[model samples]
Target: MIVITRYSVPEADSVAFQTDAATAVDVLSRRPGFRGHRIGRAADDPTLWTVVTEWDGAGYYRRALSDFDVKVQAVPLLSRAIDEPTAFEILAGGDL
Candidate 1:
Protein backbone atom coordinates (compact mmCIF):
# COMPACT_ATOMS: atom_id res chain seq x y z
CA MET A 1 0.00 0.00 0.00
CA ILE A 2 1.05 3.54 -0.65
CA VAL A 3 0.33 6.69 1.33
CA ILE A 4 0.83 10.18 0.07
CA THR A 5 0.39 13.14 2.35
CA ARG A 6 0.36 16.69 1.08
CA TYR A 7 1.30 19.62 3.24
CA SER A 8 0.68 23.25 2.44
CA VAL A 9 3.07 25.37 4.42
CA PRO A 10 4.28 28.92 4.15
CA GLU A 11 7.85 29.55 3.00
CA ALA A 12 8.73 30.76 6.47
CA ASP A 13 7.56 27.47 7.95
CA SER A 14 9.18 25.22 5.33
CA VAL A 15 12.20 24.40 7.47
CA ALA A 16 10.16 23.47 10.51
CA PHE A 17 7.73 21.46 8.44
CA GLN A 18 10.55 19.55 6.76
CA THR A 19 12.01 18.73 10.14
CA ASP A 20 8.66 17.35 11.26
CA ALA A 21 8.28 15.39 8.05
CA ALA A 22 11.72 13.85 8.51
CA THR A 23 10.86 12.87 12.05
CA ALA A 24 7.65 11.22 10.84
CA VAL A 25 9.57 9.19 8.30
CA ASP A 26 12.15 8.19 10.86
CA VAL A 27 9.53 7.02 13.33
CA LEU A 28 7.56 5.12 10.73
CA SER A 29 10.69 3.45 9.33
CA ARG A 30 11.21 1.72 12.68
CA ARG A 31 7.74 0.20 12.65
CA PRO A 32 6.97 -3.31 11.44
CA GLY A 33 6.28 -3.81 7.74
CA PHE A 34 7.56 -0.37 6.79
CA ARG A 35 9.00 -0.48 3.29
CA GLY A 36 10.26 2.94 2.28
CA HIS A 37 9.48 6.66 2.32
CA ARG A 38 10.35 9.87 0.54
CA ILE A 39 9.74 13.56 1.17
CA GLY A 40 9.59 16.06 -1.64
CA ARG A 41 8.72 19.66 -2.35
CA ALA A 42 6.66 20.66 -5.35
CA ALA A 43 8.85 22.06 -8.11
CA ASP A 44 6.19 24.55 -9.12
CA ASP A 45 5.27 25.54 -5.60
CA PRO A 46 7.88 25.52 -2.88
CA THR A 47 5.28 25.77 -0.15
CA LEU A 48 3.77 22.48 -1.20
CA TRP A 49 5.39 19.43 0.39
CA THR A 50 4.65 15.77 0.32
CA VAL A 51 5.49 12.65 2.24
CA VAL A 52 5.15 9.40 0.37
CA THR A 53 5.46 6.02 2.04
CA GLU A 54 5.15 2.40 0.98
CA TRP A 55 4.23 -0.36 3.39
CA ASP A 56 3.86 -4.11 3.33
CA GLY A 57 0.11 -3.62 3.50
CA ALA A 58 -2.64 -1.31 4.62
CA GLY A 59 -2.82 -3.01 7.97
CA TYR A 60 0.83 -2.37 8.62
CA TYR A 61 0.39 1.28 7.86
CA ARG A 62 -2.58 1.59 10.18
CA ARG A 63 -0.85 -0.29 12.97
CA ALA A 64 2.23 1.82 12.64
CA LEU A 65 0.19 4.93 13.29
CA SER A 66 -0.91 3.45 16.60
CA ASP A 67 2.63 2.77 17.78
CA PHE A 68 3.87 4.71 20.77
CA ASP A 69 6.89 6.28 19.13
CA VAL A 70 5.00 7.00 15.94
CA LYS A 71 2.12 8.50 17.88
CA VAL A 72 4.49 10.82 19.70
CA GLN A 73 6.82 11.66 16.85
CA ALA A 74 4.85 11.30 13.62
CA VAL A 75 1.16 11.79 14.27
CA PRO A 76 1.53 15.43 15.06
CA LEU A 77 3.19 16.09 11.76
CA LEU A 78 0.80 13.86 9.87
CA SER A 79 -2.13 15.70 11.34
CA ARG A 80 -1.03 18.74 9.42
CA ALA A 81 -1.43 16.91 6.12
CA ILE A 82 -4.24 18.06 3.88
CA ASP A 83 -7.64 16.64 4.68
CA GLU A 84 -8.11 14.11 1.94
CA PRO A 85 -7.67 10.47 1.09
CA THR A 86 -4.02 9.52 1.39
CA ALA A 87 -3.96 5.75 0.91
CA PHE A 88 -4.11 3.95 -2.42
CA GLU A 89 -3.59 0.63 -4.15
CA ILE A 90 -1.18 0.73 -7.07
CA LEU A 91 -2.98 -0.15 -10.26
CA ALA A 92 0.11 -0.13 -12.48
CA GLY A 93 3.76 0.71 -12.10
CA GLY A 94 7.30 -0.25 -13.12
CA ASP A 95 10.51 -0.38 -11.15
CA LEU A 96 13.31 1.88 -12.29
Candidate 2:
Protein backbone atom coordinates (compact mmCIF):
# COMPACT_ATOMS: atom_id res chain seq x y z
CA MET A 1 0.00 0.00 0.00
CA ILE A 2 0.96 3.61 -0.50
CA VAL A 3 0.51 6.26 2.13
CA ILE A 4 0.44 10.02 1.93
CA THR A 5 0.52 12.31 4.90
CA ARG A 6 -0.46 15.94 4.89
CA TYR A 7 0.37 18.40 7.58
CA SER A 8 -1.36 21.63 6.79
CA VAL A 9 -1.27 25.16 8.13
CA PRO A 10 -4.52 26.58 6.94
CA GLU A 11 -5.19 30.04 5.64
CA ALA A 12 -6.44 32.39 8.30
CA ASP A 13 -9.30 33.82 6.31
CA SER A 14 -10.67 31.16 3.99
CA VAL A 15 -13.36 28.79 5.18
CA ALA A 16 -13.21 27.38 1.67
CA PHE A 17 -9.97 25.61 2.47
CA GLN A 18 -11.51 23.32 5.02
CA THR A 19 -14.65 22.99 2.97
CA ASP A 20 -12.73 21.97 -0.11
CA ALA A 21 -10.61 19.52 1.80
CA ALA A 22 -13.70 17.92 3.28
CA THR A 23 -15.29 17.68 -0.12
CA ALA A 24 -12.21 16.03 -1.54
CA VAL A 25 -12.24 13.57 1.31
CA ASP A 26 -15.85 12.68 0.62
CA VAL A 27 -15.15 12.13 -3.06
CA LEU A 28 -12.07 10.04 -2.41
CA SER A 29 -14.04 7.88 0.00
CA ARG A 30 -16.27 6.76 -2.87
CA ARG A 31 -13.45 5.77 -5.17
CA PRO A 32 -12.14 2.27 -5.75
CA GLY A 33 -8.91 1.24 -4.03
CA PHE A 34 -9.27 3.91 -1.40
CA ARG A 35 -8.60 2.39 1.93
CA GLY A 36 -9.19 5.26 4.34
CA HIS A 37 -8.18 8.64 5.70
CA ARG A 38 -7.64 10.05 9.13
CA ILE A 39 -7.37 13.65 10.27
CA GLY A 40 -6.42 15.41 13.46
CA ARG A 41 -5.79 18.81 14.92
CA ALA A 42 -2.21 19.04 16.00
CA ALA A 43 -1.89 18.95 19.77
CA ASP A 44 -1.62 22.49 21.20
CA ASP A 45 0.21 23.22 17.98
CA PRO A 46 -0.61 26.26 15.91
CA THR A 47 1.43 25.27 12.87
CA LEU A 48 -0.09 21.95 12.00
CA TRP A 49 -3.07 19.85 10.97
CA THR A 50 -2.63 16.21 10.05
CA VAL A 51 -4.08 14.08 7.29
CA VAL A 52 -3.24 10.52 6.43
CA THR A 53 -4.57 8.44 3.56
CA GLU A 54 -4.08 4.88 2.38
CA TRP A 55 -4.52 3.42 -1.09
CA ASP A 56 -4.30 -0.10 -2.41
CA GLY A 57 -1.40 0.53 -4.80
CA ALA A 58 0.64 3.01 -6.79
CA GLY A 59 -1.70 2.82 -9.77
CA TYR A 60 -4.75 3.89 -7.78
CA TYR A 61 -2.68 6.60 -6.18
CA ARG A 62 -1.41 7.81 -9.51
CA ARG A 63 -4.89 7.86 -10.93
CA ALA A 64 -6.11 9.86 -7.95
CA LEU A 65 -3.32 12.33 -8.48
CA SER A 66 -3.56 12.63 -12.24
CA ASP A 67 -7.11 11.77 -13.23
CA PHE A 68 -9.35 13.10 -10.49
CA ASP A 69 -10.62 16.61 -11.02
CA VAL A 70 -11.55 17.07 -7.37
CA LYS A 71 -7.96 16.26 -6.47
CA VAL A 72 -6.79 18.81 -9.03
CA GLN A 73 -9.12 21.43 -7.61
CA ALA A 74 -7.59 20.90 -4.22
CA VAL A 75 -4.18 22.16 -5.37
CA PRO A 76 -5.15 25.80 -5.48
CA LEU A 77 -7.12 25.52 -2.26
CA LEU A 78 -4.16 23.96 -0.55
CA SER A 79 -1.81 26.53 -2.01
CA ARG A 80 -3.91 29.27 -0.54
CA ALA A 81 -4.23 27.45 2.78
CA ILE A 82 -1.13 25.41 3.47
CA ASP A 83 2.08 26.83 4.80
CA GLU A 84 4.50 24.02 3.94
CA PRO A 85 3.08 21.10 1.87
CA THR A 86 1.78 17.57 1.79
CA ALA A 87 4.21 14.69 2.39
CA PHE A 88 4.04 11.19 0.86
CA GLU A 89 5.31 7.66 1.30
CA ILE A 90 5.19 4.34 -0.50
CA LEU A 91 5.16 1.93 2.40
CA ALA A 92 6.16 -1.70 2.65
CA GLY A 93 3.94 -3.30 5.18
CA GLY A 94 3.57 -7.01 5.94
CA ASP A 95 4.07 -9.53 8.69
CA LEU A 96 7.65 -9.53 9.80
Candidate 3:
Protein backbone atom coordinates (compact mmCIF):
# COMPACT_ATOMS: atom_id res chain seq x y z
CA MET A 1 0.00 0.00 0.00
CA ILE A 2 0.99 3.59 -0.50
CA VAL A 3 0.76 6.01 2.40
CA ILE A 4 0.17 9.67 1.61
CA THR A 5 0.45 12.28 4.31
CA ARG A 6 -1.00 15.77 3.91
CA TYR A 7 -0.08 18.40 6.44
CA SER A 8 -2.46 21.18 7.37
CA VAL A 9 -0.88 24.43 8.44
CA PRO A 10 -2.13 27.53 10.24
CA GLU A 11 -4.39 29.91 8.43
CA ALA A 12 -6.16 33.22 8.97
CA ASP A 13 -9.38 31.27 9.41
CA SER A 14 -8.93 28.08 11.37
CA VAL A 15 -12.64 27.27 11.46
CA ALA A 16 -13.04 27.54 7.71
CA PHE A 17 -9.89 25.56 7.04
CA GLN A 18 -10.87 22.73 9.35
CA THR A 19 -14.44 22.67 8.11
CA ASP A 20 -13.28 22.32 4.51
CA ALA A 21 -10.76 19.71 5.58
CA ALA A 22 -13.47 17.57 7.17
CA THR A 23 -15.50 17.66 4.00
CA ALA A 24 -12.51 16.86 1.80
CA VAL A 25 -11.71 13.85 3.96
CA ASP A 26 -15.21 12.52 3.50
CA VAL A 27 -15.05 12.97 -0.26
CA LEU A 28 -11.59 11.51 -0.74
CA SER A 29 -12.33 8.44 1.37
CA ARG A 30 -15.03 7.44 -1.08
CA ARG A 31 -12.69 7.40 -4.07
CA PRO A 32 -11.70 4.11 -5.68
CA GLY A 33 -8.72 2.21 -4.27
CA PHE A 34 -8.66 4.35 -1.18
CA ARG A 35 -8.37 1.49 1.28
CA GLY A 36 -8.44 3.60 4.46
CA HIS A 37 -7.44 6.89 6.05
CA ARG A 38 -6.88 8.61 9.37
CA ILE A 39 -6.78 12.19 10.61
CA GLY A 40 -4.22 13.35 13.17
CA ARG A 41 -3.83 16.59 15.07
CA ALA A 42 -1.52 17.62 17.88
CA ALA A 43 -3.07 18.81 21.13
CA ASP A 44 -0.36 21.44 21.66
CA ASP A 45 -0.01 22.33 18.02
CA PRO A 46 -3.16 23.50 16.34
CA THR A 47 -1.35 24.25 13.10
CA LEU A 48 -0.16 20.68 12.82
CA TRP A 49 -2.58 18.07 11.50
CA THR A 50 -1.74 15.02 9.44
CA VAL A 51 -3.99 13.16 7.04
CA VAL A 52 -2.64 9.65 6.56
CA THR A 53 -4.31 7.99 3.60
CA GLU A 54 -3.75 4.39 2.64
CA TRP A 55 -4.17 3.56 -1.03
CA ASP A 56 -4.03 0.35 -3.02
CA GLY A 57 -0.96 1.85 -4.68
CA ALA A 58 0.54 5.10 -5.95
CA GLY A 59 -1.32 4.76 -9.23
CA TYR A 60 -4.60 4.77 -7.35
CA TYR A 61 -3.78 8.10 -5.74
CA ARG A 62 -2.60 9.55 -9.02
CA ARG A 63 -5.84 8.57 -10.68
CA ALA A 64 -7.94 9.94 -7.83
CA LEU A 65 -6.14 13.27 -7.98
CA SER A 66 -7.33 13.63 -11.54
CA ASP A 67 -10.84 14.33 -10.31
CA PHE A 68 -11.57 18.05 -10.42
CA ASP A 69 -13.66 18.06 -7.25
CA VAL A 70 -10.93 16.29 -5.30
CA LYS A 71 -8.27 18.76 -6.42
CA VAL A 72 -10.49 21.74 -5.69
CA GLN A 73 -11.28 20.51 -2.19
CA ALA A 74 -7.68 19.63 -1.39
CA VAL A 75 -5.58 22.55 -2.70
CA PRO A 76 -6.74 25.13 -0.19
CA LEU A 77 -5.95 23.03 2.84
CA LEU A 78 -2.30 22.64 1.90
CA SER A 79 0.29 25.04 3.27
CA ARG A 80 1.96 27.43 0.85
CA ALA A 81 5.28 25.94 1.81
CA ILE A 82 4.03 22.52 0.82
CA ASP A 83 3.88 22.42 -2.95
CA GLU A 84 3.41 18.67 -2.73
CA PRO A 85 2.71 16.06 -0.08
CA THR A 86 4.80 13.03 0.86
CA ALA A 87 4.09 9.37 0.09
CA PHE A 88 5.50 6.19 1.61
CA GLU A 89 5.26 2.46 1.14
CA ILE A 90 3.85 0.53 4.09
CA LEU A 91 6.30 -2.16 5.12
CA ALA A 92 4.25 -3.62 7.92
CA GLY A 93 1.04 -3.07 9.86
CA GLY A 94 -1.13 -4.33 12.72
CA ASP A 95 -4.45 -3.52 14.36
CA LEU A 96 -5.32 0.15 14.33
Candidate 4:
Protein backbone atom coordinates (compact mmCIF):
# COMPACT_ATOMS: atom_id res chain seq x y z
CA MET A 1 0.00 0.00 0.00
CA ILE A 2 0.98 3.62 -0.45
CA VAL A 3 0.28 6.84 1.42
CA ILE A 4 0.19 10.22 -0.25
CA THR A 5 0.12 13.27 2.01
CA ARG A 6 0.03 16.74 0.54
CA TYR A 7 0.80 20.03 2.19
CA SER A 8 0.57 23.70 1.33
CA VAL A 9 3.53 25.52 2.77
CA PRO A 10 4.38 29.18 2.68
CA GLU A 11 7.48 30.12 0.71
CA ALA A 12 9.23 31.19 3.89
CA ASP A 13 8.73 27.77 5.44
CA SER A 14 10.02 25.67 2.57
CA VAL A 15 13.46 25.07 4.03
CA ALA A 16 12.16 24.20 7.48
CA PHE A 17 9.50 21.97 6.03
CA GLN A 18 12.03 20.09 3.94
CA THR A 19 14.21 19.49 6.98
CA ASP A 20 11.30 18.31 9.08
CA ALA A 21 10.06 16.06 6.28
CA ALA A 22 13.44 14.45 5.90
CA THR A 23 13.60 13.81 9.61
CA ALA A 24 10.17 12.26 9.50
CA VAL A 25 11.21 10.01 6.65
CA ASP A 26 14.32 8.91 8.50
CA VAL A 27 12.38 7.96 11.59
CA LEU A 28 9.80 6.13 9.52
CA SER A 29 12.41 4.23 7.56
CA ARG A 30 13.57 2.42 10.67
CA ARG A 31 10.16 0.91 11.26
CA PRO A 32 9.24 -2.56 10.12
CA GLY A 33 7.55 -3.08 6.73
CA PHE A 34 8.69 0.23 5.38
CA ARG A 35 9.27 0.02 1.63
CA GLY A 36 10.42 3.43 0.37
CA HIS A 37 9.47 7.07 0.23
CA ARG A 38 9.80 10.22 -1.80
CA ILE A 39 9.30 13.94 -1.10
CA GLY A 40 8.10 15.93 -4.05
CA ARG A 41 7.19 19.52 -4.92
CA ALA A 42 4.70 20.27 -7.65
CA ALA A 43 6.21 21.84 -10.75
CA ASP A 44 3.28 24.21 -11.19
CA ASP A 45 3.08 25.19 -7.54
CA PRO A 46 6.24 25.48 -5.52
CA THR A 47 4.41 25.75 -2.21
CA LEU A 48 2.62 22.49 -2.87
CA TRP A 49 4.42 19.38 -1.67
CA THR A 50 3.72 15.73 -1.12
CA VAL A 51 5.21 12.95 0.85
CA VAL A 52 4.71 9.50 -0.65
CA THR A 53 5.55 6.39 1.30
CA GLU A 54 5.17 2.71 0.45
CA TRP A 55 4.68 -0.02 2.98
CA ASP A 56 4.28 -3.76 2.91
CA GLY A 57 0.59 -3.22 3.68
CA ALA A 58 -1.90 -1.00 5.39
CA GLY A 59 -1.36 -2.70 8.73
CA TYR A 60 2.31 -1.90 8.67
CA TYR A 61 1.57 1.69 7.90
CA ARG A 62 -0.83 1.99 10.80
CA ARG A 63 1.55 0.23 13.16
CA ALA A 64 4.31 2.55 12.17
CA LEU A 65 2.19 5.50 13.19
CA SER A 66 1.93 4.08 16.70
CA ASP A 67 5.63 3.79 17.26
CA PHE A 68 7.03 6.25 19.79
CA ASP A 69 9.74 7.55 17.51
CA VAL A 70 7.32 7.96 14.67
CA LYS A 71 4.83 9.73 16.86
CA VAL A 72 7.43 12.23 17.95
CA GLN A 73 9.43 12.71 14.76
CA ALA A 74 6.87 12.30 12.04
CA VAL A 75 3.37 12.89 13.29
CA PRO A 76 3.83 16.62 13.67
CA LEU A 77 4.77 17.09 10.05
CA LEU A 78 2.14 14.65 8.83
CA SER A 79 -0.52 16.42 10.82
CA ARG A 80 -0.13 19.39 8.50
CA ALA A 81 -1.07 17.41 5.41
CA ILE A 82 -4.16 18.57 3.57
CA ASP A 83 -7.35 17.32 5.18
CA GLU A 84 -7.93 14.47 2.75
CA PRO A 85 -7.55 10.72 2.58
CA THR A 86 -3.91 9.74 2.52
CA ALA A 87 -3.74 5.97 2.16
CA PHE A 88 -4.61 4.04 -0.97
CA GLU A 89 -4.78 0.35 -1.69
CA ILE A 90 -2.66 -0.32 -4.70
CA LEU A 91 -4.68 -1.99 -7.46
CA ALA A 92 -3.82 -4.86 -9.78
CA GLY A 93 -3.19 -2.82 -12.89
CA GLY A 94 -1.54 0.27 -11.42
CA ASP A 95 -1.83 3.02 -8.82
CA LEU A 96 -4.91 5.01 -7.85
Candidate 5:
Protein backbone atom coordinates (compact mmCIF):
# COMPACT_ATOMS: atom_id res chain seq x y z
CA MET A 1 0.00 0.00 0.00
CA ILE A 2 1.07 3.54 -0.66
CA VAL A 3 0.15 6.79 1.07
CA ILE A 4 1.08 10.05 -0.56
CA THR A 5 0.47 13.43 1.01
CA ARG A 6 1.25 16.76 -0.57
CA TYR A 7 1.93 20.03 1.22
CA SER A 8 2.20 23.54 -0.10
CA VAL A 9 4.37 25.51 2.26
CA PRO A 10 5.58 29.07 2.07
CA GLU A 11 9.32 29.62 1.65
CA ALA A 12 9.53 31.03 5.16
CA ASP A 13 8.04 27.86 6.61
CA SER A 14 9.91 25.33 4.48
CA VAL A 15 12.30 24.37 7.27
CA ALA A 16 9.54 23.93 9.78
CA PHE A 17 7.46 21.95 7.32
CA GLN A 18 10.32 19.57 6.59
CA THR A 19 10.96 19.14 10.30
CA ASP A 20 7.33 18.21 10.85
CA ALA A 21 7.45 15.80 7.94
CA ALA A 22 10.51 14.11 9.37
CA THR A 23 8.81 13.80 12.73
CA ALA A 24 5.83 12.22 11.01
CA VAL A 25 8.08 9.70 9.27
CA ASP A 26 9.77 8.82 12.54
CA VAL A 27 6.48 8.20 14.24
CA LEU A 28 4.99 6.20 11.41
CA SER A 29 8.10 4.05 11.02
CA ARG A 30 7.50 2.58 14.43
CA ARG A 31 4.16 1.17 13.40
CA PRO A 32 3.77 -2.43 12.33
CA GLY A 33 3.97 -3.16 8.61
CA PHE A 34 5.71 0.09 7.70
CA ARG A 35 7.72 -0.73 4.58
CA GLY A 36 9.46 2.53 3.84
CA HIS A 37 8.98 6.28 3.59
CA ARG A 38 10.29 9.26 1.71
CA ILE A 39 9.85 13.04 1.70
CA GLY A 40 10.67 15.27 -1.19
CA ARG A 41 10.10 18.69 -2.73
CA ALA A 42 9.03 19.15 -6.32
CA ALA A 43 11.95 20.01 -8.58
CA ASP A 44 9.91 22.53 -10.53
CA ASP A 45 8.06 23.87 -7.50
CA PRO A 46 9.95 24.03 -4.25
CA THR A 47 6.89 24.95 -2.24
CA LEU A 48 5.29 21.69 -3.25
CA TRP A 49 6.40 18.88 -0.91
CA THR A 50 5.23 15.36 -0.48
CA VAL A 51 5.48 12.53 2.04
CA VAL A 52 5.24 9.09 0.57
CA THR A 53 5.01 5.95 2.65
CA GLU A 54 4.80 2.29 1.71
CA TRP A 55 3.07 -0.18 3.98
CA ASP A 56 2.44 -3.89 4.03
CA GLY A 57 -1.19 -3.23 3.30
CA ALA A 58 -3.99 -0.71 3.64
CA GLY A 59 -4.90 -2.01 7.10
CA TYR A 60 -1.42 -1.30 8.43
CA TYR A 61 -1.53 2.20 7.08
CA ARG A 62 -4.93 2.86 8.63
CA ARG A 63 -3.81 1.39 11.94
CA ALA A 64 -0.72 3.58 11.92
CA LEU A 65 -2.94 6.65 11.75
CA SER A 66 -4.90 5.41 14.71
CA ASP A 67 -1.81 5.06 16.88
CA PHE A 68 -1.82 7.55 19.73
CA ASP A 69 1.78 8.62 19.23
CA VAL A 70 1.14 9.18 15.54
CA LYS A 71 -1.96 11.20 16.35
CA VAL A 72 0.08 13.52 18.56
CA GLN A 73 3.18 13.83 16.41
CA ALA A 74 2.05 13.23 12.86
CA VAL A 75 -1.62 14.16 12.58
CA PRO A 76 -0.98 17.90 12.68
CA LEU A 77 1.32 17.70 9.68
CA LEU A 78 -0.92 15.21 7.95
CA SER A 79 -4.00 17.32 8.58
CA ARG A 80 -2.32 20.12 6.70
CA ALA A 81 -1.89 17.87 3.66
CA ILE A 82 -3.88 18.78 0.55
CA ASP A 83 -7.45 17.54 0.72
CA GLU A 84 -7.45 14.68 -1.77
CA PRO A 85 -7.19 10.93 -1.94
CA THR A 86 -3.84 9.81 -0.47
CA ALA A 87 -3.98 6.05 -0.40
CA PHE A 88 -3.18 3.90 -3.42
CA GLU A 89 -2.31 0.37 -4.49
CA ILE A 90 0.82 -0.37 -6.47
CA LEU A 91 -0.01 -1.76 -9.88
CA ALA A 92 3.68 -2.04 -10.85
CA GLY A 93 6.88 -0.97 -9.11
CA GLY A 94 10.40 -1.90 -8.08
CA ASP A 95 11.69 -1.85 -4.49
CA LEU A 96 11.49 1.65 -3.08
Candidate 6:
Protein backbone atom coordinates (compact mmCIF):
# COMPACT_ATOMS: atom_id res chain seq x y z
CA MET A 1 0.00 0.00 0.00
CA ILE A 2 1.11 3.54 -0.69
CA VAL A 3 -0.01 6.82 0.82
CA ILE A 4 0.38 9.99 -1.16
CA THR A 5 -0.20 13.15 0.83
CA ARG A 6 0.12 16.54 -0.79
CA TYR A 7 0.65 19.80 1.02
CA SER A 8 0.54 23.37 -0.13
CA VAL A 9 3.23 25.36 1.55
CA PRO A 10 4.09 28.97 1.21
CA GLU A 11 7.67 29.80 0.26
CA ALA A 12 8.26 31.36 3.65
CA ASP A 13 7.42 28.14 5.43
CA SER A 14 9.31 25.76 3.15
CA VAL A 15 12.27 25.39 5.46
CA ALA A 16 10.19 24.61 8.52
CA PHE A 17 7.98 22.31 6.49
CA GLN A 18 10.95 20.37 5.20
CA THR A 19 12.36 20.06 8.69
CA ASP A 20 9.09 18.77 10.08
CA ALA A 21 8.70 16.39 7.16
CA ALA A 22 12.14 14.96 7.79
CA THR A 23 11.23 14.41 11.40
CA ALA A 24 7.95 12.80 10.46
CA VAL A 25 9.75 10.43 8.12
CA ASP A 26 12.29 9.64 10.80
CA VAL A 27 9.61 8.83 13.34
CA LEU A 28 7.60 6.78 10.88
CA SER A 29 10.63 4.88 9.65
CA ARG A 30 11.01 3.42 13.11
CA ARG A 31 7.52 1.98 12.98
CA PRO A 32 7.13 -1.76 12.37
CA GLY A 33 5.16 -1.95 9.13
CA PHE A 34 6.78 0.93 7.30
CA ARG A 35 8.36 -0.04 4.02
CA GLY A 36 9.92 3.22 2.84
CA HIS A 37 9.12 6.80 1.96
CA ARG A 38 9.97 9.63 -0.38
CA ILE A 39 9.66 13.39 -0.10
CA GLY A 40 9.07 15.45 -3.20
CA ARG A 41 8.44 19.00 -4.30
CA ALA A 42 6.65 19.54 -7.57
CA ALA A 43 8.89 20.77 -10.32
CA ASP A 44 6.25 23.05 -11.70
CA ASP A 45 5.02 24.22 -8.35
CA PRO A 46 7.60 24.66 -5.68
CA THR A 47 4.97 25.28 -3.06
CA LEU A 48 3.49 21.85 -3.63
CA TRP A 49 5.13 19.07 -1.63
CA THR A 50 4.29 15.46 -1.22
CA VAL A 51 4.99 12.72 1.31
CA VAL A 52 4.80 9.28 -0.17
CA THR A 53 5.04 6.27 2.06
CA GLU A 54 4.88 2.57 1.34
CA TRP A 55 3.35 0.39 4.02
CA ASP A 56 2.76 -3.30 4.55
CA GLY A 57 -0.96 -2.71 4.43
CA ALA A 58 -3.75 -0.39 5.41
CA GLY A 59 -3.81 -1.86 8.90
CA TYR A 60 -0.16 -1.07 9.42
CA TYR A 61 -0.69 2.46 8.18
CA ARG A 62 -3.67 2.91 10.45
CA ARG A 63 -1.79 1.51 13.39
CA ALA A 64 1.09 3.85 12.72
CA LEU A 65 -1.33 6.75 12.99
CA SER A 66 -2.18 5.67 16.53
CA ASP A 67 1.46 5.47 17.57
CA PHE A 68 2.55 8.00 20.17
CA ASP A 69 5.50 9.37 18.22
CA VAL A 70 3.45 9.69 15.09
CA LYS A 71 0.75 11.54 16.92
CA VAL A 72 3.23 13.93 18.45
CA GLN A 73 5.99 14.40 15.91
CA ALA A 74 4.18 13.69 12.69
CA VAL A 75 0.51 14.40 12.99
CA PRO A 76 1.00 18.15 13.07
CA LEU A 77 2.79 18.10 9.77
CA LEU A 78 0.42 15.52 8.29
CA SER A 79 -2.57 17.53 9.31
CA ARG A 80 -1.53 20.15 6.78
CA ALA A 81 -2.02 17.81 3.87
CA ILE A 82 -4.73 18.88 1.43
CA ASP A 83 -8.06 17.22 2.09
CA GLU A 84 -8.43 14.45 -0.44
CA PRO A 85 -7.93 10.74 -0.98
CA THR A 86 -4.42 9.79 0.07
CA ALA A 87 -4.09 6.06 0.60
CA PHE A 88 -3.92 3.66 -2.31
CA GLU A 89 -3.70 -0.10 -2.93
CA ILE A 90 -1.23 -1.33 -5.50
CA LEU A 91 -2.92 -3.09 -8.37
CA ALA A 92 -0.10 -2.95 -10.91
CA GLY A 93 3.44 -1.68 -11.23
CA GLY A 94 6.54 -1.50 -13.41
CA ASP A 95 10.20 -0.65 -13.00
CA LEU A 96 11.12 2.93 -13.72
Best by lDDT: 4
Instruction: Say which prediction, candidate 1 or candidate 5, comes out ahead on lDDT.
Output: 5
Query: What TM-score does candidate 4 reach?
Result: 0.95
Tell me the whole-model lDDT of each prediction, alpha carbons only: 0.94, 0.59, 0.69, 0.96, 0.95, 0.95
Tell me the lDDT of candidate 4. Answer: 0.96
The segments of candidate 5 whose C-alpha lies over 4 angstroms from its true place after superposition are none
Steric collisions counted per model: 0, 0, 0, 0, 0, 0
Question: Could you tell me which 10 consecutive residues in candidate 2 have the lowest summed lDDT?
Answer: 78-87
Off by over 4 Å in 4: 93-96
lDDT of 5 at 32: 99
Candidate 3 C-alpha error for residue 44, in Å:
3.3
Cα lDDT of model 6 by residue, 1-96, tens digit:
999999999999999999999999999999988999999999999999999999999999999999998999999999999999999999998984
Candidate 4, residue 54: how far the Cα is off, in Å: 0.1
- Model 4 lDDT per residue over 1-96, tens place: 989999999989999999999999999999999999999999999999999999999999999999999999999999999999999988865454
Error of 3 at 33 (Å): 0.3
Tens-digit per-residue lDDT, 1-96, candidate 5: 899999999989999998999999999999999988989999999999999999999999999999999999999999999999999998898753
Stretches of model 6 off by over 4 angstroms after superposition: none
Shift in Å, residue 52, candidate 1: 0.2
Poorest lDDT segment (10 consecutive residues) of candidate 6: 87-96
Worst 10 residues of 5 by lDDT: 87-96
Please identify which of the two predictions, 4 or 5, would achieve the higher TM-score against the true structure.
5
Model 3, CA-based lDDT = 0.69
Model 1 is weakest, by summed lDDT over 10 consecutive residues, at 87-96
How high is each candidate's TM-score?
0.96, 0.62, 0.75, 0.95, 0.96, 0.96
